[model samples]
Target: MTCVSCRTGLDHCHGTVLLHVDGGAECTEPDCADAVLARHALVVDCDSIEGGCACEVTAERLAHAS
Candidate 1:
């Protein structure tokens, strides 16, 4: 599926999908979320399935050590 706002393919959106509370979906690409917001849409949630991006995991581990 493609993002409703940015039209980015699901596979190439870096696994970040922004969900509108009312309806619709978009990728988290640069300005993509802003585009959705410009339409007066509320992004109440998001799905991050980018398992390959370990930024979050590494941050968590470092935080725990601190």
Candidate 2:
């Protein structure tokens, strides 16, 4: 599947897909998250990644660490 915003394949998109913690929106990319946070001053949470995506495993680990 592709990212709704970027049209990039989720499996190939760079950066982590994060959800805005304030119920704003899901970020299409990690850099997108940073940009949104910087621009709008909002905090975000990492959304569950696709199971077959390479980032899926690392995302879980990071989630647990935080």
Candidate 3:
């Protein structure tokens, strides 16, 4: 998948996760948010990190989700 911030193709980006609060689902890649929002879902980063792309927070949420 391509990064939402960088447009880089990533084969290992699945290590991240984004949670759509109202939709009760999570997206593992940057592009995943597109689908969640398309479903009229509400999502948040839900992760706190010092410096990185917003998508980087997915790493934290992914660990928690699993």
Best-performing candidate as measured by TM-score: 1
Clashing pairs in 1: none
Which candidate leads in lDDT? 1
Question: Which 10 successive residues of model 2 have the least lDDT summed?
Answer: 8-17
Q: For residues 1-66, what per-residue lDDT tens digits would candidate 1 score against the true structure?
A: 645655743323233455643345665566544434445334434334444334545556778999
> What does candidate 2 score on TM?
0.23
Per-residue lDDT over 2-57 for candidate 2, one digit per residue giving the tens place of the 0 to 100 score: 44544643323344335533344444554553444433333345444444434455
- Model 1 alpha-carbon drift over 4 Å, by segment: 1-47, 50-52
Better of 2 and 3 by lDDT: 2
* Cα RMSD for candidates in order: 10.0, 10.9, 12.2
What's the residue-level lDDT of 22 in candidate 2?
39
CA lDDT, every model vs. true structure: 0.47, 0.46, 0.44
Better of 2 and 3 by TM-score: 2
Write candidate 3's Cα lDDT for 1-66 as tens digits: 555534543223333344433334455455654434444333445343235444455655877899
Residue 52 in candidate 2, Cα distance off native in Å: 0.8
Cα-lDDT of candidate 3:
0.44
